[model samples]
Target: MAKGKDVRVRVILECTSCVRNNVNKKSTGISRYITQKNRHNTSSRLELKKFCPYCHRHTIHREIKK
Candidate 1:
């Protein structure tokens, strides 16, 4: 038996607006979403437009390290 590389990996995406706003003011919480991505195809960080409850608008969410 041999070990194989993981094709799909779980990723966490956080709201960009919330992250920048948090520096100036205190926020209740930042919007976060869990999703899966193909490592071989998406070598760079994943970003998507998502709704943020805190910001109350669709913003760009970037992948963060675990």
Candidate 2:
């Protein structure tokens, strides 16, 4: 028997606002989050609303390549 691929995979989510406007930012970094998702369940990219320290508020964080 062979091992199969994992259904749950780790993904990196980044702040959309930070990536869009990177120049002259209040913070020198972009907000990111690590989370696991089921590939079989949702094929599309993941989008989550998370708190961003730099943005100083909650923003829509979209999944990005690691």
Residue pairs whose backbone atoms clash in candidate 1: none
How many clashes (backbone atoms < 3 Å, residues ≥3 apart in a chain or on different chains) does model 1 have? Answer: 0
Q: Which digits, one per residue and each the tens of the lDDT, describe model 1 over residues 20-64?
A: 899988677889999999999999999999999999889999999
TM-score (all chains, Cα) for each model: 0.88, 0.86
User: What local lDDT score does residue 36 receive in model 1, on the 0 to 100 scale?
Assistant: 94
Q: Write the per-residue lDDT of candidate 2 for residues 1-66, one digit (tens) a residue.
A: 433588888999999988877875656789999999999998999999999988899999999987
The whole-model lDDT of each prediction reads 0.92, 0.90
| Backbone N/Cα/C clashes per model | 0, 0
